[model samples]
Every structure is written in C-alpha cells, then in structure tokens.
Target: MRATTEEDATARAAVVARGCSSPIRTATGVWVRCGSRIKSKCESCAELYRNDWAAIARSGVFDGPVTEFRFYLLTLTAPSFGRVHRVPRDGGQRVGACSCGVEHSATDAGLRGVPIDGDMYDYAGQVAWNRDAGLLWDRTRRRMRDRWDSLEYFIVREWQDRGVLHVHAIIRVARFEAPTPGVLRDAALSATAVSQVDAGVLVEWGEQARCDAFRADGDGAKTIWYLSKALNYVLKDVATASVDAPIDVWRHQVALGDAARRMRCARDCQPQDCMNLVHKRYGSRSQVVSASRRTRNRTGWSFTGLTRTVQRRLRREWWESRMRDEAGDDAPALSPPPLEDLAARSRRELIARGWSAP
Candidate 1:
C-alpha cells in the first residue's frame, strides 16, 4: 500500500506491532513500511502475506463523525407446531459450545438460547422475515429520522448471510459543535416521539412478515434496538425449529433415492459477489481488491467472518440474556425483523391466508 502523503505514514506508524528478541518467539506484529518509514516488520507474518498490499484502518480520526453500529444476528427458536430442536446458541448451559461446537463460559456467554432462541417461538415468520430484511430496517431509519428529527444524518445498512437470519448497520449522526455529546444512550433515546416512530415501523414490518415479530405482541418501540444496530447484516445459522427447523428424515431419504443432485445446486445458492455486496452496501465503489482471495487478510471471508461470527456468538451468549434479565418478564429489546411494507405484505398475506391481491 503506497502512502499517499506524510500524514498517512505517521498514522500508520501508531498501530504497528513490534517484535521482542526471544529465541522462543511469539508471532511478530505487522505494519507496512519502507527503509525510512518504519523498520517494524514481522518476517514470520510477512511470510503469511508476502504479496499483501492493503492499508491498515483505524477510527476516531474524523472530526464530528460519530458512528453508531447495529449488528443483525438471528434469534433462533422452535417452529410453530413442530418438534423443537433448533441449534441452541450456547446449548442451554452457562459454559459450553453451541450445537455447532463453539465453546465459551456462561459468565462469558450467558444462559444458552436465552439471547437468540427460546422454546415455543414462531420460526416460519423469522425465515420469511430474513429474505429482504434490509428494506424493513431502511424504512425504520427513515421513520426514526422523521419522528425524532435528531437522527437525521446518514445510515449504513447491510445484511449477513452467514447465520440463520440477521442484519448490520452503521448509523452516522452528525454532531453539532455547540452542545451535542457522544452516541445516544438508551435512557436519553427513549423519548415519546422516538418511541411512537419506532412503534409504527415495527408494526409495519411485523404485519408484513405475517407473524408477530416481537416476543411481546404490541407496544414495543423501547425494544427495537436490534434493527437499529445491524450494519454488517450477517445471518447467523440458527438452531431454531421455527427458522432452522429439522429437515424431514423421510423426505431426505426419498429425495436421495429419486435423483442424484449436483452438489453445485448448493453452490447455486451462495452469492459470487459477497465482497461486492459489502462494497455496494458501504458505498465504497472502488475499494481496492489488490490482495488475492486466498491470502489471510481482513477483507477475506475467514478473518472478517470469524470476528463477526464470534461477535454474534458472544452477543447472543452475553448481551441478549442480560437485557432480558433487565427487562424481566417484559420482553427484552431486539431487532425488529426486516421486511417489506404494507404493499408487499398485502400480496403475501393474501396468498398465505387463501385470499387475493388486487
């Protein structure tokens, strides 16, 4: 990565990792530089990416540009009227791996399934909700701005396809130089105007997905924090019967005998332009793709996905349960499932309930 100017060089120098001279060595910290730039480079890690050429990124440099991030993660649960065995987010223990073999402590991860899933949830609605969750949340951002007037800045909206169903967003609220503070806090954000705006948007999405999206049926603007924070938009693979319900063993057996399906059929489902989608979502049209796909880099699938996935796991395992605890029997705060508005909802509900759309 070429340093465009001297300031870039100085900024890059700040986070550069250094090495200690110990025969029994730990890996070296990495930074991109030249002879006069910064001599700090880990030869061991340099071997990991000899062809690497991407600038390291840091935050808090921009003046008056405060960012609010919303990560959309799937909340798993049992499908309606179906046998319940969705992958437990933490398998119902204080400290253990998820059904997917992810391991962590309850003090660290929280009670299993308390955050993402619980027994007796409407799973079908969640899946249907996932299909176009972006549009749903986008509407909320607009409505929120209109109602509150304080949030009238910019929104970074996107989704994550890795997990069951989820979204991610970066809300940029412009700061006034006079008296504005940092990111808006919960208590400060819970004004009547804001709550009413949330209610309208929430009801609209719930009605579209054709299921009550919230744990509590009505009056839940205070709990829609989930939709507000989803900028990365990765859908976590859920273990809920409702959303990721068990496949029918009999149906699978019959399909195996009837035909030989190409494994590529599964490949057909995955998108070729995930990085491109990320690029589109972030409005970074000409983002440098100079590094090879195989290289272990920040933008690659493994590194970014791993950090995001672990975060989802940690969030499901930690934050959700705590919020539920704080909310008590009252339903905990969560992302409002993203969905189409009344126009789209009318078409689908017509079909689901055996009616017609005019």
Candidate 2:
C-alpha cells in the first residue's frame, strides 16, 4: 500500500511538471492553468507558449508549397547609444580589445553590455527608439512589399543586454520575385521612418544588419529552429535586475529604468499621470513576437490556420476532456462561464485576498 501511494505521488508530480501546479479557479469553479509565458513565473505554461509559437513558425516554413517561396532570415539592430564593452560569451573566442583599451576575457560577463561611459550614454534616445521600434518595422515591411510584392514575415523582438530591442524576422517571398540576400539587406537597412509622435525624430535601423537567404527545402528548417529558440528571450522583462549583478551592471539598469520612467510614451503623455506599462518596461510598448496577418491579397505568415487563439481553445478543450476522463460521472460542465463573469469574480476574489483589482 505504501509503494502504491508513493507511485501515485510520483505520477502526480510528473503531471504537475507538464501542467500548472497552482491552477486558478474560474467563475465556473473550474480550474485552469495560469497561462503565463514567463518561464520564471510558470515553467509548464511557458513551455506550452514556446511550443505553440514554434509549431506556428514551423508551419509557415514546412506546411506550404516548398519550392515556390524563398526564405530569408533577417536581423536588424538598434542604433548605438554609446560605446559598450564587447565581452564574449563563456568559452567564446575574444574578438579584440574593447574601447577601454583592455582585452576583456569571456569571464568578464558583468561588463558585457554596460556602457563604457554611463554619463555619455544616450539613455533617453535608447528608450525613445524602443518606443518607436514597432512603427519603424511597419514602415520597413511596407517598403519591402513595395519592392517585392509577395513578402510575408514573422518577426521576433529581443532585448539586447543593454536594455534595447532588436528584431529578428523570417521573411518569405515568391521565388521568382526574391532578391539576392545582399540587395535585400541593403534595402531593409536603408528603409527609415519618421516618428509619428515626435515630428523631427527619424527612426532607422543600425548600420549592422544581416539578411541571409536559404532554400525552403534545405536550410529553411534550420533557420526556423534558430528563430523559434529566440522565443525564450521574448517574455523576459528588461527591468528585472539580478541579485548578483555587478555594481556597474546594476547602475546601468537603474539609469535605463529612470530614463524610461521620465520619458514621454506619446506626445501628449504626462510622465506622472500616465499609467502606461511602457514606462515600466524600458519604453517598449510593442508585442515581443508577431507575424503578418492573413489578408484578402496576401497569404499570412503561417501556412496553417494556427494562431494563439486557436492554440488556447485547443488547450482548453484538451484540459476539459482530460478532466472528464479522470472524474467520470462527477466531472463539472466543460463550457466556461462568460468572460465578464469570470473577470468580475476574479477581481472580487483578489480584493478579498488583500490584492487590488486592475
């Protein structure tokens, strides 16, 4: 009997590792996974989020007509705010001496992204660039489509260690219309947009950009894998500071946060009165990951009709079915209560538990 109990406990533990350990009780009194994409918050749900997007990304590459489309992986970086340390990753070969006139070893990780001169760093400009990155991308896509009419893309925005955003995009274009990687890179790098909020501000990609073309049948799968792995970086909060962070690193983050707090998110934004989350997120307001949408004229980024909404619905149905199987005749109704009712109940529950409602 003890052995049976131990086995049962082990099985439950395994199940929890794959699903939510602390499930939320909804208005219908049905338990649901707390769908957080941050791995630090919920490993199980984060894995699910990663997998769903990975599958969607793969579908865009493998599900459609293979030979008819050309695939390219493009990386765009933000303009430099200031000179920074160029410490290599652990076990990585040292590139060269840094601007500080010292050859930093790979072990010098603390100084990796810290500005060489913090006072001289353009923190305000960096945050403003983050705020306008989405608009810049919108302009970039429009420019690309103007030249190559059959372009569709999936883009992921990643935070550089210095607390700025850079973009990685998987681009697909009709085979006949696709340009050489160099031409594409030049065109994309040259494209610029003026900020709608700040009339005089010109938003542009950094000089360092890459566009590499790969055959959809050959290196395409590998490219998709590379991009999918970057999803891990998407949900991380740039403002989160490490407990063991070096003094310089900590100071850098503090400066960036301070700049973000005081910066206007919009032309009419009042820094004190504004409750915009961008102020707290290093001035970044755009979604971390997104793909072009299906339209009347263009095929969307995904070849399959797979989307986050569809994935969520499927997960809900699967969870309900599993519950029914486990509970047999005692299972609750599978249908969820109205969203408004659930939200209201959740708010009340939070308030009763000494937490403020949104």
Candidate 3:
C-alpha cells in the first residue's frame, strides 16, 4: 500500500499476501525476479512478504535465543527548582511537591498543580534523533561496555509510541565470566558511564532523561513486557510526553509507575527474559534465523515494529489518509476500525482472525 490509506490497508494486505507467493527463495534469485520488469510477484509471494513482516512485528524477539540480562531506564533533567508532580494521572488531579523540605499531596480540585517551566530540554530534537535512535543507543552501549571487565554481546533497541521512546536491550555478560551484580548494575557506572557516553552523543532525550535498570521475567503473553526491565519507565515515559504537550493528561502515572516497578522487579525474578545473551556488539552485520524450534523462531523483527508507538502511528496515518481519500472521492465518512486492530495483524490475517471490522 503506497500510504496505508483508508481506501484499503487491510484489503491491500490481503491482496498482497494472497497474490505474491512463489516459494520465495531467500537466495539472490528471489530479489532479481521481484525487482526485474520481466518477473512478476504472485499473490502468494506478496502474502509471504507481508506475513513475514507481520510475523516479525508480532514476534518481539530477536533471531537467536533471548539473553537474560539487566537494563536501566534513563532520563536527563534540567536544573529547575520547583514542586514537581511525582505521579500525575489521567482524569485525575495534578499533584506537585514543593522544594521547601516538605512534601504535600492534595487533590487539586481545580487541577492546577502541574507546571510548565519552559526549561525542559528540547524534546522535538530528541524525537528526531530517536528516528535513528537505535544507532545512537548502539554507540552508547559500546561506550558503556568498554568500562566493563568481561566483554559480552549487547543489543539495544528503541521502541516509540505516542511520542514516548523506551529503550529495550539485551546485554550479555560473558558466560562463566559474569560481573558482580553491583558492578553490572553499578550506580556509579550508571552515572559515569551514561554521562561519558551521552556527552559524546548529542541527544536531548526530550526535556530530561532518566535512567533506571531493568531485568526480564516472564511466562505471560506480554510477559516479555518487562516492568523491572523498564526501571523508572512510568515517570520517564509520562514526563517526556508532558514536556511536549500543550495540555497533558499525565494522570496515568500511577498505573505506569506500577508497571515500571514490576518490570524492574522482573529483571531478577525471571531467568528467561531476553531472546539470548548478547556477545559481540553489532558492527555493520546482520544474521538470519530460520523458523526452526531449535534455532530462531518468529520473534524476529515483527514483534518489535509493533511496539505501541510505531503501531499507533501506522494506524493514525492510515486513518487520516483514509479520511482524506473519502472526502476526495465524495464518499460519505464511514467510521473506520481502530488502528490498533489493524496494527496487530496484516490485513489478510486480520480478516482471517475475524479481527477485521472494516
């Protein structure tokens, strides 16, 4: 689909999927045929390609076994002196604390507690950097790894949704050569290493960046959604949105906080959290995993691209585009299905699963 327009993202997916199969050779022949004018893609070929993407977006794991390691949440704040809202809620009161050595909580009946100081870091710039954020984070990881005693592979990824970016990573501490937990999760390293790396890298990380450590735990469907691994996820996620918004409904902080704490706690609780322990840092290289049980499974790229932000944006863009097309074609406005439903599946599979409500 050229632009995921409303005219038919689902239908487009269905058509592409059903029409484009040709036993896609992972070999060079497939590329040559698909790209050449002499060759044409059948429905099965298209479906295979689209389904591959769907599978990756939905899989959420890397090509290899998941690594079980700890990660930290990061945030950088400007020096401002004022009462801050520790936990803001949606459809809830805006609570702020005073720096006068006293903490007070009152239900802001008028909802006037949250403040806009304008000193917050440049968020727009950070989001732009986040576009290539995966790379920036990679560089940061290298810097941090250098300080470690034992070398291991590390993978860092950025997940963005609704303008919020969360850093998910798989850090491998060398087998039988593990660093002490204090050293691995060292607060000093959290400060020094992060600062050193951040200094070399230029990212605004929206007003400020906060870093907290995460460890993975699971057995649940969204079990991969590590809360402890999200260390400090709630506040940072919410705060970043606040700085960029004209009006913030940061009322979900409580729920988010609970989730973040859980993710952090999970780091130590679950042993099978990551896809696999990383060894060597990535360097202009890529790996291929087959859909074999003993080897890499479906959790390739599919599960990742589906992170709430990317999925939401895909949906929103499609909806707006669809609306525009409707107006242009003089078609009456029809209530479109939620973009989320669309994001969760390729158009064909979605229709098959009966999640399609178009």
Candidate 4:
C-alpha cells in the first residue's frame, strides 16, 4: 500500500473497484510485488525480509558502536501447555523426527509447528502463550534495565521444540558491566510470573532459560545474525499458523485440524479478541518480531535500500555525468553527498528515482 499523510476519500471507491492484484510497476521501472513475509505467498519478498532483518540485527550490534556496552544472547522459552508435533534436538543433532509418519525435510513448512494429535493439542492455551510471550520478554528486559540505563535489543519469536512459542533475543546493556549467567537466569525466572492468559491459565516460561554472554571481540554480530534465522520460515505453514484468523477458522484449522497452526493469539480465543486485549492493555499492535525504541533510532537503521549510501551516491553521479554529455560542455558539476543520516539520504535517492509518497 502507498504511504499517505491522509485518506483520499474521493478515490476510495475507485481504488476498491481496482481490487487486489500482483505487484505494480513503479516509475523507476521496478516491479513492486506483494510484500508478503510468508514464503508461500512470495519467496522473493521473504528473501527480502531475511536480508533486511539480518542487516537490521547486524546493525543493532555494531552500527551505533555499542562497544561501550556488553551484549548477551538470551533465550526465554514458553512453558509447555500440552504435547504437539515437535522436532527433537540434542546438541544441534536431530534427536528424532515427530511422531507423525512422514519424512520431514528442513524446508518442509507443512511438517513443522503442527500437533502430533490435533484432538489433544491445547490450541486455546497455545494462542494465549503466544499472546503474552512478548510481555514476559519485556518484563525481563525491564529487569535488565535496572542494571544499565542504555539498553537495546531485538527479539524474534519462533515455534519451538514443541508446538509452543519461545523468544530468542539479542540483549545489549550499556556501561560494559556484564552480569553472570546465573544472575541473568534469575532475572528471567522472576519475569516468568506473567499474567494469566485465561480464567485458570497462568502464563509462565519453561524450565529451560539460557543467557550466554556474547564475546567482546566479534561474537556479538554472530549472536545477532543467529537470531535472524526465523525471518524466513515456511511461508505456507506460517500462514496456516497465523494468529489473525477468526475464531472458527483458527479453531478448525489450527486447534483441531491437521494443518500447521502457527497464527497469532490463542485457540480458545479468537484473533480479534486477543488483539483487543493486547491493544487495550499495552497500547501496542501484535507483531512477530520487534525492536525497542533505542534500537530503532540507530543511525543507519532505516537505510534498507538495495545499495549502500556511498554506492547510491556513486550511481547518481554516474547518471549525472552521462546526462551532462548529452548537454554539451556547460553541464554543472555533480553535487557533494548530502550531510545527513544514511536513512535520510536513501529516502532522497528513492525520490530521485521517481518514488513518490502517497
């Protein structure tokens, strides 16, 4: 959708008449296809997601020179509500596949994040866990902030060993005072006292919580890059697991049906219900992956175009020189690079290439 300052009410009828279709071509002769993060809907867009988020995670590590701070790889897992289809893992080796009678490949979206027995799967509970997992994570981070003022992090939610949800985060604390693993574990444990998801359903983290200190040298980048893996998952499977579906759709497809149910919210609760709860309480929208305010304000954080800043300037100059040749010798010299943040410069470059704000 086009980014606009306000609604063009007059065009609403015409726009609706056009309906949804494939990606549209821009003035730059580039085809802007459907930007679905789900791989099933659009593989190219998913790849774009992987590249963009990977850079974002990487930038969160080294971009702002978080050198004064120490980084940690923290994992907060969800407590098991019930047994579902799971890919067992031990020491990075497959312990065994799911009980489901099928050979599952690494890229098999259909086989992952599903219940071994749909009838027995706690679909409603699972949805509740997904809803509160982010809050639990925030509580843990707030506890961490008590130790340092300048804290920055990015978290990724993944469907884990069981059909449950867990969080993987890249936590950075300022002042270079790294806490021991035990202390970090204790902080996480205290945060696990998350609010109730239902009448009798209290949300909690699983027994296994890990906090590994990132190496001061270069491991910080590696840790962040590691967590970015979830940005590109089985598109179809994740869509099937969507948390935004209606009650009947979510229950039949995710809670009771054999299809992989990975969508947002709880099985007992409908998507709209869960969304309203989250918005009312937290004043925030639901999202799979998210970053803190400080993390988002990094210098180059928003420069996610195809080329880097210098490369874009060079390309612009090359184009200008060619245009000058056509105008005989009186063409003006190429202007110097703008003295602004990379993101701002990139936005100008996009506009120069014929991108207009709606």
* Best prediction by TM-score: 2
lDDT against true structure, model 1: 0.26
lDDT score at residue 93, model 1, on the 0-100 scale: 49
Tens digits of lDDT, candidate 3, 187-272 = 22233222221235444233334444333234322423342233223222223333543243343233233223222121233323
Give candidate 3's TM-score: 0.33
lDDT value for candidate 4? 0.52
| Candidate 2 lDDT, 1-358, residue by residue in tens | 6796555434433343346544454444333455566777778777777888888888788999978988899999999999999988876686799999989997788788899999999999999899999999998999899999989898888988888999999999998998999988888988899987678899999988998988878898788788777888766555545676678898898898899899998889999888787998888988878888888887898887778777666755665566568758875343332221233347446435542111
TM-score, one value per model: 0.26, 0.85, 0.33, 0.58
What stretches of model 4 exceed 4 Å from their correct place?
A: 1-21, 24-33, 84-120, 192-201, 234-236, 239-253, 256-285, 295-358
Top-down TM-score ranking: 2, 4, 3, 1
Q: Rate residue 229 of model 2 by lDDT.
A: 76
Worst 10 residues of 1 by lDDT: 53-62
**Top-scoring candidate (lDDT):** 2
Clashes of 1: 31
For residues 1-358, could you state the per-residue lDDT of candidate 4 as single tens digits?
A: 2343123322331232122233433443332333455665556655655665666676666655466667777787776655454443334545355667654555444434555555776655655566666666777777776775566667777755334566777776655666776687677677654444344545577888888877646686567657766645422353345555434334434442222122333436454434343423111223556666523444222223222334435544664565457546874442332221233324435545544222
lDDT of each: 0.26, 0.79, 0.33, 0.52
Error (Å) of candidate 1 at residue 58 is: 6.2
> For every model in order, what is the number of clashing pairs?
31, 0, 66, 13
TM-score of the candidate numbered 1?
0.26
